[model samples]
Target: MTTFRKIAALAVAAVMTISMGACGNTGSSAADTQDLVVARSLETTDMLPQTGFSNGDIWAIQQVYQTLTRNKTDGSGVEPGLATSWKQSKDGLSWTFNLRRGVKFHNGRTMTAKDVKFSLDFARTARDDKPWQFLFTAIRNVEIVDDYTVRLDLNEPWAPLPSDLSMSASSIMPADFGGKTETEFRNNPVGTGPYKLGEWKKGDYIKFVRNPDYWETGKPKLNSVTFKYVSDANTRSQMVQSGQAQIDEFPTAVSVSSLKKTRNVHVESFPSTSLIWVNLNNRRKPLNDVHVRRAMAYAIDKEAIVRAIYYGQAEKANSMLSKNLMGYSKDVKDLEYDMAKAKEELAKSSAPKHFSLTVQVQSGDPEKSMLAQILQESWKELGIDVQLQTLDSTTVYSNRTAGDFDVAMFEMTNDISDPDEWMQYMFSSSANVNSGYRNEKVDALIKRAAADSNQANRLKDYAEVQQIIADEAPEIPLVYKPGLFAVRDQVKDFTVTTLGEYKLADTTIARE
Candidate 1:
């Protein structure tokens, strides 16, 4: 399917929440409410694909699914998950995975090649729109060689196929789980991950329990985990401090400051792969001009946003990729913040004066508000009036995909180990043309990186590609947002990964 159509479908899918059942500890009383509960500002919709895909949803599902390989929370590349061992063909068109035996799903089904085939095939053809679907589209098909062996056949030479499978979407599910409607599965679900879906009370909380027959033996450190969607950052922080929540994700810096004053909680940060930027709506007349786009970049100050909003948690971005990535280029620096330069570009342009644009951001995100305020003030200096609109995460993604907003701000991650996996989705004509961006040179470079397997060549090619995009100024780079997550002091053996995912298979929570 085309990227636009997929994004439209995803927008529609976001309207509904996944309904699941709640199961308490088998040995405890019904009134017991304590379970490694964590609070966050958003809730996930049920239409989420079975694949360990989607941006925000992966954080929750990371506890419920396992991939062929996993990242160690410290920003490392790919590591093992379900498949204990794997081998690739010399031609790089075929791959075989050797699954660890004695794995069982939450539904008591033995995990086998059939399940692997079912999970991968469903991800490739699932009806619901998922953000990471772009990662799996290269696969022609998957074949079950034996009870524990699976082989993947690709349409073309794709070296990153194994690393792509290491992502969330490649999580294996029971064969029977395939071909089911998203609505049906949302209400009732099963997986082979560490925890099983229990009760989901919409607008209240989602509860989970340890899976007795989980593929990984004798693990899942916590007895249970529950997630509550408390949209207010203050409320989420208070919950953690009051012992109502054991952990939380990205509490406001202000709230974190207060928590540090009294609570025994600990804060941890990992290198986030997300790159937040302004998607200049090129369909508009003035922004269509390269000078206007360049001017917009110069007017906004990234340093202020990092200091005032992020409190130095974020690193200013000059290129599409993060500094930690293999293909990142350090030659590009932050655009100079000069109102005089911005006015110069506006005067030079043949476009009319008094240009206006709208930026859509998430309502609850503090950084979004800070960015919006800064842009509004900075652009005003150049006789440009910009409107800032804040919406929920769901609304933001929906409008962005539909091209409803003129200029929008949001974040994107490098999902696979290779940059091609992400760059293709961003620059490919087939992907959602956020900002209505298109360039033949960018397209050619992305394809070249996809076909080339040599590490040195791929890096050079991708570096040139990033420089090309930076020069053209399609999307304005903002900052590499830090992955700030808080865990209770007692939650030992937990490692924060660069990809922002957790593998609970071997984790253990100790308490005296």
Candidate 2:
């Protein structure tokens, strides 16, 4: 009763198994396994921008659609996805892509340059300050060169433009479908990817069907995938163990030990640099004080939390930036639990007696609750009342962007491998206006890092930026999370990335 799952080289298929008592289990075929069930701890409530489901749902719909280019899962870099190949001009401001020949949308219409122009333009024109909208604004404009050729004009000399094109949000859809109202498009999506949306039972399940002529040369092996949202990690894991589901994501660190001892379940720990931090809103009263922020940093015991909650599977992060990141510093010391310092800060702060602080916590995510409780107890030692306010992830994230909380804990996974990726989103004045954290020095350093293409020079600039953040104390760093995923023994070719995205295009499921 052992299942080993690995995502294939292409990350499309998966290897999974369901064993019965003493009898060995056998895997099913694409025709028979048309119902591939997956359970996730995160819920997909509505299709809004910036969330995994909002974007991932669009990606699924686009699989019925297609993109101009694809990041080959083989790691050779960006290659032909919906587009056969592409080339850039010497100035690097303009680029052209040769579309895949004879590719048709799920609606049976042929893909054309108009489709490319319409999709990119619509995403950009439909911009909001939300993160997804920010992603789209990077493209200056797009034009139709021919029925099969499309060109993109850049606003700046972006080296990662090709990689950005491969993002799930950059998915291309039918031109006619572009200008439709949100409600209309959600009802009927015509993508060029491998799977077509068959049915969406709001709040329950989203069913997909394999496109008969998916552009990837007779792949989409599993016929269809059924994503069932279960916000509870224990329940999701149980669904997989009970033969009700094939794959499940985000099992708690506590359940890892027991799940590992189980007969047929295979677990893989992905080393991710995604770090959870206590974002001290500078606009708030007590938290607005720098000493108060620094004292809260000294109050939390990083070692105890990592050991007790994460089971020593995670690394203690000293700086807001992680060690695995490019500008990581080894000199930053751990902020041990110091009651004296916490008291000193409480006294130093001119705020009145009985000062209260609120820390927003997502309803079901275990780490948030655990971290909040640990921090609450630690802060209580200094006669401070720290309250944990539990809210739905949607509400919590929304309020965070709106600058409505005193203290909040959130984790960030680097989207790209650059110093700017970490600094740009959090400290830059532009992002700060939205995220509610701004430092002039941080803004300058980020601008320098973004402008400098040289790695060595960029590193120096980012190192200074990190030191500024360390001193400013707008946010307190906690721990670098390790992503945990479980696959059935029959599943193979799976790899989890630091970004927490599970790409299943090349995985294959086999009999155990």
Q: How accurate locally is residue 495 in candidate 1, as Cα lDDT from 0 to 100?
A: 61
The sequence of per-residue lDDT tens digits that candidate 2 reaches over residues 71-133 is: 443333466777778887877677889987788777777878888887777656653444544
Candidate 2 — what's its lDDT? Answer: 0.65
Prediction RMSDs, each to the true structure: 8.2, 7.2
Reference-based TM-score of each model: 0.87, 0.83
Q: Which candidate is the best by lDDT?
A: 1
lDDT (Cα, tens digit) per residue for candidate 1, span 40-126? 766655524453234556666667667787765555567777888888789878888898888887777778888888788877873
Q: Clash number for every model? A: 12, 43
Clashes of 1: 12
Cα lDDT listed for each candidate: 0.68, 0.65
Q: In model 2, where do residues sit more than 4 Å from their true spots?
A: 1-31, 46-80, 83-88, 136-138, 176-179, 321-354, 417-422, 432-435
Give the top-scoring candidate (TM-score).
Answer: 1
